[model samples]
Target chain A: MTLTWDMQDAKSTDDRDVVLEVKDLRVHYATPLGDVIACNGISFKVYEGETVGLVGESGCGKTTTAMGVLRLVQPPGRIVEGEVLLDGVDVLSLNEEELRRVRWNQISLIPQGAMNSLNPVMRVKDQIGDAIQTHESRAREAVKERILELLNLVGLPARVYNMYPHELSGGMKQRVCIAMAIALNPSLVIADEFTSALDVIVQRVVAQTMLDVKDRLGMSMILIGHDMGLQAQLVDRIAVMYAGNIVEIAPVEDIFEESLHPYTQLLIESIPSIKERKPLKVTEGLTHDLRNPPPGCIFQFRCPYVMEHCREVEPPLRELKPLHEVACHLFEEQDGKIVDISDESVV
Target chain B: MRGLTPGYLIRRLGMFVLTVWLGATLIFIIPRLAPSDPVAAMVSRLLAQSGSVEGSAEMIEAWRARFGLDAPPLIQYLRYMRNMLTFNLGYSLTSFPSEVEDMVVRALPWTLGVLSIATVVSFVLGNTVGALLAWRRTPGLVRTLLPLSFTFTAIPFFMLGILLIYIFAFGLDWFPVSGAYGRALTHNWNWEFVKSVIHHGTLPALSIVVTSMGFWGLGMRGMMITTDGEDYMILAQAKGLHPRRIFWLYGVRNALLPQFTALALNLGLIAGGSVLVEYIFAYPGMGYLLYQGIVNTDYTLIQGIVFIMIMGTALGVLMIDLLYPFIDPRITYETR
Candidate 1:
């Protein structure tokens, strides 16, 4: 019956346009003692023309996951195992030259710190021109026009074309990075906390510029950051990572309203609310060492609702509802609704 | 573009002039501070040579009068400053009738030709080796071998000169051991003179280059390492730029800024620092002239050489100051 259905599914649909697919991607940083698993076999797919927010607290492998996808992790950090499929091509399998050709042309990056992402000595035009010229050799005038077009697309003035990175303001620099990321009109762009270094007002402006550009260019993006507020404003789907593994991933509203995993629920509660006065939620336990994670769930040590089964068996990410996935042992699908099996009574 | 304003230029030039003035005054005061007078010292050497010359006291007085030493201290200072401005340095005490200006002019070309070549070669070679050593993508064998080239830096350049002379001159008989050119070649503007000069100056130049390149290499390696961690470098890689392009345009270009500043300082000190090397090789340059002046207590010659050195150094610093804004756009003088 499955084979017959597979034959009938030969034509691809528009909604299933998976621009980037990261499967079982494991990244590790080699230390003297052992490998510290930064991204532990995390998998996700980014559909075309949508933003996926990889959200977690600092050091929870959000940035590592982005770097792993770009193949830009520095020394001591190694992509131990994984396949980063950009437009159905395995990025990990490419040679250096081949990989270089694939980068920026198909997948560009708006780096973590926009303040230093640009070459200080280089002019804004040259830095943006580098991305475009590397992939396709265009006439000088054409390249210049395209660069100015990109700057305008990101809501920057034309005079910025001649200015060095030092001459620009922080928001302008972040916008410059955003402009460069879209210079080549890449299929997938990874923006790693692109606005984390800006003021709140500037952050909003830059975020709006990003959204406008992404909409105009019709590009898919992975926005990596810990700002839940920003994620809510920008991203379509949110992947909440904990201890190097994505614990829960779902549509934006559902994760905010009906998060399944205990870690996800705590994360939602931790979001600061201005309307009500409540005691701050302080998690009790510390995170386990990444180099030596326990034999059960990654969040077991910090999970407030930890149980006997959670301590002995590692839980796999399972789809408990349509488009919502959770990695916790307490929840089970029963009668078309997720129910707490451990409660021993119906709610 | 904004830094090369006329006011900034004038201020920079004013600073250069101040440096030269202070340096000139110090050199003048320092020589006079010594207990022995140049005339008296000359007389004593003559007396020792001829076993008590007749009327030595009269001769000393007559010589002092001829050399304008009979003037008061203030008069002497005014005269000295006047002569310095006019480029009319007095006759050497030991080599009378041979003006200090002529001696310097004759020696200047040889020193500039060889030393400049050596300095530029060492800087380029050292920086390249250093950059490659720190670069992550450089081949291991190349990195390993590059460090061995800079080992000569541990040895004094004169010592290296002697070693080169011993191996290449005495042992192999491939090159001349001493002097700026072969005895057979006349000093003229011709290919033979240039070739013979190069052939003879090889050992001295090689000694300086090989010994000093390691300093530049070590400095460049440190800078390259620091530049490697810059956010731009990672972003450049992420942009899919060619590795060679990133290494040169981003990595080496930024690392080379401090090295250029150091180069200017090294260039300023070149004339003074080559003394030992020149002494060992008997190369007739400013350093050799300096050695002669020191040994003979030729006050005029020494003063001339020191003034020229001060001028060269101040000029070098001024040039670098003006060129800095072009090199690093962030260093604009327009704000001030």
Candidate 2:
């Protein structure tokens, strides 16, 4: 089924609408022992020109959800039981022929480790030209011209066209990847942990460069990162995932200030802020295994305010306030009315 | 930084000369150090041909002087080095009528023709099929062929050669039993001669091809499997490149770096033809000549053949070093 986002909730001041909506996207990997559920019913939406960040610690299935959105997950890790609606076309259902047409033209990916993401043996121009060459038979001059334009767009020199990947620095190679990603002017770009491998300074530069490119091109994006601070600086909305489930999602401002999910609150507190220098709060338990997850709320084991019923029943993601959603039994109180945890009376 | 500089070229050329010189010295000295003197046999033969005591001493002196055996060992070695430096290897002791150069030139084509073609064909075909097998996406009989390829590689070349000879030569009678061409056809530039040459060369060529193709295929497959793990491979796929383009352009191109060196060294391996197999097939190649040179202790012939081997391998190494930069961008020729 096509994943649908209600128009009222999709309302934004910028007047853009949803370009990508992932609903109940469950990606599982089959191993010798058993099946590991990487992404269990994950869902999110990216509106036009919006940067939706999927923030989580490593192995929390953030990349898997992004791979699902692009239909690029390989064998043994299948995107099972999901709808990845890119511009209303279920990318999950597209055959090889149809997917070829959509991939890199309508949607592209700036893969993780862009430093080595390019073909090392090929020149930067040829590597970038591969995207154009695959979708359409463009002229050599046109390809060269497009590569130069893309290099210009990514702040790379035209001389990089003939250089191999080994000749470029880590940051330069990443820029080349950005150029290739937007070569076709795809409507959506997925940046999967793109800045995780860069230094703090280069990270900011590349992240801003990506934002500048996004602003100039007016494309939607799904940026996956573990750093909430990094996500806050760039994305409009943040979907904080835990153990293959989106525990909380709201505007970047609200995710930090008015986070209804305890996990999100803990995550925000756990960041060692330079302004405060407070001792970082560490979560007490290992993440639940996807192979055999608990029967009830996945976070109940580590959750501080776990109710008796939370151990037995799963809590669906419910909207506790305008544009703020949290999956927690704590929100299921006071006769279905939303409870403000910050208010002293609730404690 | 990676440009081919004059200094680097000069250094490599110097290295090539040093290697050839060392090889020539060892071959020249090792045979002299042997217990039995090859020159003594020729001297005794010369003495037997003379009538008797009358002018026998003069005849012995003439034979020794002709072969440079009358001089001190060190002087003889120096003279031999100078002769080899000028491309003169004297006459074969066993086949005294022919010069060492003449015999080697006559035997060159048989070894080069069959082995060179077999090696190149196997390299191309094996590497292509190997890249396909390790691509991991497409499936159909690749896994089945995997074990078989490894098994084929594990089998020794001579054993495989013997097996092919047994099956195709003896059992089916499909190809010639031995030799480079029909004895009836004289070596010429005509189609008939070429056709007969190929016809007789098929079995030996097949022996080399079957034994060697497996090694190249196995090597490339391993390299491809390693390359498949490289992030560029995923990047190529994400670029929406066709499976075929990615297989060749990204996968095989990178996978070829190691295999290319193997191919260059295979040039050396080409000249060192299968002595046992060539002997069994009675092919008139360097290997057969090498066998005869060793058995008869034809010092001049042995030294000549060994010199060719040393030159062939040294050239192969030099070619590999020169082409490495082109194959892999990481290899740069830096100035000292």
Candidate 3:
């Protein structure tokens, strides 16, 4: 884990405004086949009151990274090494008792699969109330008031308070989940695939609700999802992940306009936007098997402009502009020369 | 809070009629189809009482007509159902004119007392233990208990009764091996009679509880295990609720739903009594009476016992269907 990582070239962007800073987060799952490196040394930061979208296709460790942030990774899948600093406190260093205090009060997760997440036998209000009452001793009326406030914030009616999970529609359940996530006013809320399960109409409503709640409550959020279009609508900055690694991190407009990484460009092009309706640029090759990933770049096999050195060593994430980083040899600065990777490496 | 829509109630009541009618039809046909003519059996027993050398043909016909057995099978079935519905089970053929209703009344308390206590005790013990086992799942403790509980369920009901009687009654001289109470304690509301009833009921109740508690425990344990791993459970943990509250309230409460319905249905069938277990212990419960009814070809008694059982089961099913929705907010009695 102490392997030499080349971050000296890039200026340290760690600031007081950073709500959460995850450094070299690695998570591995011991399956029957082999150890699957679900998240491999992925690092990112979420600024206070800013929504950072972790975008990737399925099985690319996007969700794993979110789990690492919340310290919710369970048995068989262990967070092997990482330093998760939330508000400058290392959450990873906290023991079980301390983690409980940190979990819902400081950082909560609106988990994936909204349909199966809430307790079917419990009322939605109690579900939210339980999260509140767990950390603090509050009067019954006080808890009820807080639950009502949360429900209102998520755009759900007060009538939904007494209803069970099964009685609610998918959209309502997701709202309840979001309500629970924000019940304690956690400084950071991670919504994993918050709207993926819903149809287009419900997705838009849920996305709107997410924005409203985030803006109103003023909490940093990490929205992990597969839909780039949906992520683009909600997040200020997007981190594009590919096979347990983030290939690019840039503002949403910058990613859509000019992406330095080949994978990022391919991902942006793959989105079927009405504005970018030129042609369907199909990304070729297959996703890397996490158990037996290649020695060099995980995206090298799928890169349209693959180079010799791309197959030899992995490129480190480097800042090409302020707050924009790209992990590709194309952006590398060699000695005093800005190496023309386009002429030498474009295949 | 729809309060069970009228449509669901009426529909369920209609189904109940169908079920009871089916039960009555089975009872009506089963005796007629049997080789032993109950009329003939009653006639012979009657003739023997009178010290007749051989039953005359005329006498047999007279007795058959008197009992309405000479009519067509359909008319006889109708008459039988009318008698059953009116709670007049007629005279027991083997018991020599003793009303089947009276005999049933005499035998019911013995079975109910033993079984109700056993079922309730075991249900409480099994479910609590099962939940604890699921919550505090130490591998070593589970490894030791899993096999023993499974083995208890594997042992046949009567075999376990006999084994209990051998170990606790005949060997240890701890309890009476047979009968409802002490012979010296006359039937009364006195403490001695009640104490004797409980004292004698111990072995039979123990057999029932010991054999079937394993089922409830294992069922609840399995339910807890599956429900424990569910998304709601993870959500509970993420909620940062205390571990104890989560285990009992969220974990066991959901797990206990299936077991609750099962228990209600089983307790509903308690009217039928533990047949072989009661017979082995000689606790003259409804099961013992039913056994005697079958052996003596007492169709009236058999029909009476079976009707009670059918009614009990139907009521149990109906209660679960309608009342369970009220018990569990997840269930809805509204017509889909």
Candidate 4:
């Protein structure tokens, strides 16, 4: 059975069926003090065969959201409230057995730190074969054959199957991880900082391999990264998240060119490009703590174009133009004010 | 086979020589430094009982000459080293009628047999239990059982030996109380004698097992927990491996590597049996032989037993060093 769904509104001409839909997701971690709302009522959707880039600073709940979807969160950190509908079924509602069936077969995760993810004592082939044997019923010989096929798919020679993890280089290990993630041909794959550990040159190759795999497998991806330039080259749509809330969602070109949200604009301006010889503008103030989020908007302290209304009341996400959404009071007409402030005041 | 580096081997050999020299000095000097001369004491007692000085000086001189006690301390030490090099372990002072070699030869096999069985059983049981508890998010019953198993290891071997004797020998009467065999067969080497010997050896063997089993279990458990946290285990899970496969193939296999080294060390040190435990159980093992030598001041027998223990431990360490590269390809004798 094909496990895929659509999440695009009827207004857009590029409406593809949604592969995954996350609605009103509220995942809180019970700390010593109280509930630290990691993902506070956040919502988004990914369409079939589309790459959605989740860009945010550290501790902004991007990684937590991904882990929550996979049900990989350990104790004290939990998905307190949410609907993670994969295809049509709510993943959060599934029991352990049901979760096991869908985990690698329907949706796979390329976890963070690829280099350390493999067993040093085991042969790489046996490690890969383990996954195949877990979700499928096959003979030992057949599993061995499938492992070889997977190695070939990930651009690794079959010889790597007999070698241990320590024998392989960093790049080779990451490739093996990629191969392992796609061993089951899952419809949706989440690549969580997969290329973050490699050198710049290796990162490029690994990133390109991820894109190539997605193209070949015809799979949708939720690429979570802090590197905006890398995401621009790979992801089809970018969702700019700050303090556990996506402040902007737009096509890659729109995000780079006409970013409606001030935070998104600042983020894009910060990226060092050859043509843009201007000094890279960095947003002032560190990322806010998610435990006790500010009164209204989470980004009020860091937002350069923050208004009094932005601090007192939260701005709901509103469409500024076709296929572009922003959650800022300045963009909307509120109480007869255009709300555009002078550039000096923001500086 | 890289073996040990030339420099490392030289260092180890130098250390071995130094240890032997120090051990010999301490053994000989402590006896001499005592307030009373043992030979003089023996002669004085003999005179007191007989009430005669007839052949007293000649008898003392003969005793001194026979054992090389008449020589200077340095000369005696040199003679001891020469005899050690020639593999002539000299005669026992207590077992003057019988040779020290005969005593050690007769005791060695019994000690090895019981200790070997106990060590192997403890390792298997401890490691299996530890691995299972570590790999599984165990229930409260298993958690309770684990701490209780560790309790057996916490008690001293000799104390446990006495406890087992009181319970099994006196209270419940399941096993024989003491000795290698029943008094019925003195010269018989048949199955009946062998069975009785094994039955009597059980309590002492169990004492060693209880005292050492917790170490293996705790080691395996710690290693398994660390291995579980490793990237490879997560990778295995990510690869869609079944929980069982993850537990055995990834968890247990990697965890067993360090535990194997501990087991090998235990095997090497087994030659030095628990002296107190052997005494309590009255088992005719090396420990009992060593204890008898110490009590009777049989320097030759004590030196012989200590030498065997040192060699056994050294050989065990050497075996582990050689086997390391075979078990873990990442480890290299030259590099690390």
Which numbered prediction scores highest in DockQ against the true structure?
A: 1
- Ordered from best to worst TM-score, the candidate numbers read 1, 2, 3, 4
Give one digit per residue, the lDDT tens place, for model 4 in A72-153. 7655788888889899889899976788788888888887888888777667887777677778989999988888888888
TM-score head-to-head 1 vs 2, winner: 1
lDDT of 4 by residue, B93-144 (tens): 6667677778888888888989899999999888878887786556778777
DockQ of each: 0.85, 0.71, 0.67, 0.51
Tell me how far the alpha carbon of residue B237 in candidate 4 is from the true structure, in angstroms, after superposition.
2.8
Query: What overall lDDT goes with each candidate model?
Result: 0.89, 0.83, 0.84, 0.79
- Kindly list the interface RMSD, in angstroms, of each predicted candidate in the order they appear: 0.7, 1.2, 1.2, 2.0
DockQ winner between candidates 1 and 2: 1
Candidate topping lDDT: 1
Instruction: Please give, for residues B1-336, the per-residue lDDT of candidate 3 as tens digits.
Output: 445888888999999988988998898887778798766766677777887836467877987898898999889988887887798888887776699899989998888888899999989878876776777434676656655654677888899888888998999999998999998878998998888988999888888887888888888888998988787787777777787778888898899899979987997899888889889988889999999988877777888899889988898888778877766787777757
Model 3: colliding residue pairs: none
**How close to the true structure is residue B263 of candidate 2, measured as C-alpha lDDT?**
87
DockQ value of candidate 2: 0.71
Candidate 2, pairs of clashing residues: none
- By TM-score, the better pick of 1 and 4 is 1
Candidate 4 lDDT at B156 equals 82
Error of 1 at A296 (Å): 0.4
> Can you tell me the CAPRI class of model 1?
high
Pick by TM-score: which candidate is best? 1
Residue A21 of model 4, lDDT score: 83
Please list the residue runs of candidate 3 whose C-alpha ends up more than 4 Å from where it truly belongs after superposition: A1-15, A334-347, B1-3, B44-55, B71-75, B128-147, B189-194
Native-referenced TM-scores of chain A, all candidate models: 0.95, 0.93, 0.92, 0.91
What is candidate 2's lDDT per residue for B124-227, written digit by digit as tens? 87887777778786577766665565466677777887888889888999888888888898878899988888888887777677677778887898999998
